[model samples]
Target: MNKLIDGFLRFKKNVFPQKRALFRDLAGAQSPTALFITCADSRVVPDLITQSQPGDLFICRTVGNQIPPHGSAPEGGVASSIEYAVHALGVQHVIVCGHSDCGAMNAVLHPERLKDLPSTNAWLKNAAAARSVVLENYVGLVDDVLLHLLAEENIVAQIENLKTHPAVAARLARGELQLHGWFYHIHSGDITTYDAQAGRFAPLDHGSATATPPRRIYHFSAGDAA
Candidate 1:
């Protein structure tokens, strides 16, 4: 708590003053370009990672960076946040980022080991799909390797889940929005993007962009409306 208070004091005295005009402009209105979804992990700072300024990326965080399928519940904070970012804020891109050394994924891989933390056990239920996907697809890797694969697969899985939201689906269909899956390696300080064509996560080199291509716009048909 003391560390956080001191950090804020330093921010007010130095960082805030240095970016006062940018903060002032953002105070009135914000038009962020991307919706960045990731884990609720203290190590993963979206703004710092992406080098984004204030009002650049609207963020949504969950225990495992999970996005429950649309209509799974009538009302959810994650769903509402996604809808607002897409339909209201008109964010152009949605990024689902998962990181290495994810505690949520680690717990899912070894549930019995953490039987003491009932609340943690319950929260990690959200990552059940991620666990199943990894178990089915990655058969023989040892614990560490399996955990890494699960972390990467979770990012891809959640991006697909993100598209299940009505607003996100509608916008994507109209070529008005794009979705991305990314994995951040904490140890290496490297970012990798899921290549739909290659069906793998590859390093995010400047020459190898993995962003989805814009789709052709189409008029909303009866079946097309979400």
Candidate 2:
């Protein structure tokens, strides 16, 4: 843990001092613009990827970036965070981001491997739909290709799950919020966004803006599955 303590020391002595005024202003209150939901993977840093400053993105990191669909549970942690971000913090956008080499998705794709971690197995049930969707649609894919597709499909599935939240639905109804699905390529630091218009994901050349998308999350119909 010395490494972590040293890192904090640097943050306090260097980074924090550099942004002291920003931190001082933010100490009183924060009005972040978006709720950034991503995986617990250490490789994917939201602030680093987006170049966002403190008080910009209220982050929720989960294993596999799993978000239970609304009404599935009475009071899920993800649900509470969503409500707080949308209704209380007034975050204008919600992003469900998945990354390559996701251990959570890897385990989901091979449930047999999670035999020892009962809790992790249970938590990932929130993403079981993505697994089913992939098995039915991506019949022959394997290895890295399978994992990559799983990560992408998981992002799409979680975004749909995010929409099931009542607060999210209400905000969208009033045209106050937008939801986005993102696939972050870890090795290259490239991000691809869901092209709601094309019914697929497209490479975000630089970045994307927060606006009401013309379309929403894509779910594979029975026929669409392999």
Misplaced by over 4 Å in model 2 are 206-226
Kindly list the per-residue Cα lDDT of model 2 for residues 91-179, writing each as its tens digit. 98898899999999999989999999998998999877888888888887767888888888888888888877899988787777888
Instruction: Please write out the lDDT profile of model 1 over residues 1-226, one tens digit for every residue.
Output: 9999999999999899899999889888889999999999999999998999989999999888888878774228999999999999999989899999999899889999678998677767667777898899889889999999888878877777787889988888888897888899888889999887788888887655444656877567898776
RMSD of each: 3.3, 7.7
TM-score of predicted model 2?
0.89
Q: What is the number of residue pairs that collide in model 2?
A: 2
In model 2, pairs of residues that clash are 136-226, 137-226
Residue 8 CA displacement from its true place in model 2, Å: 1.4
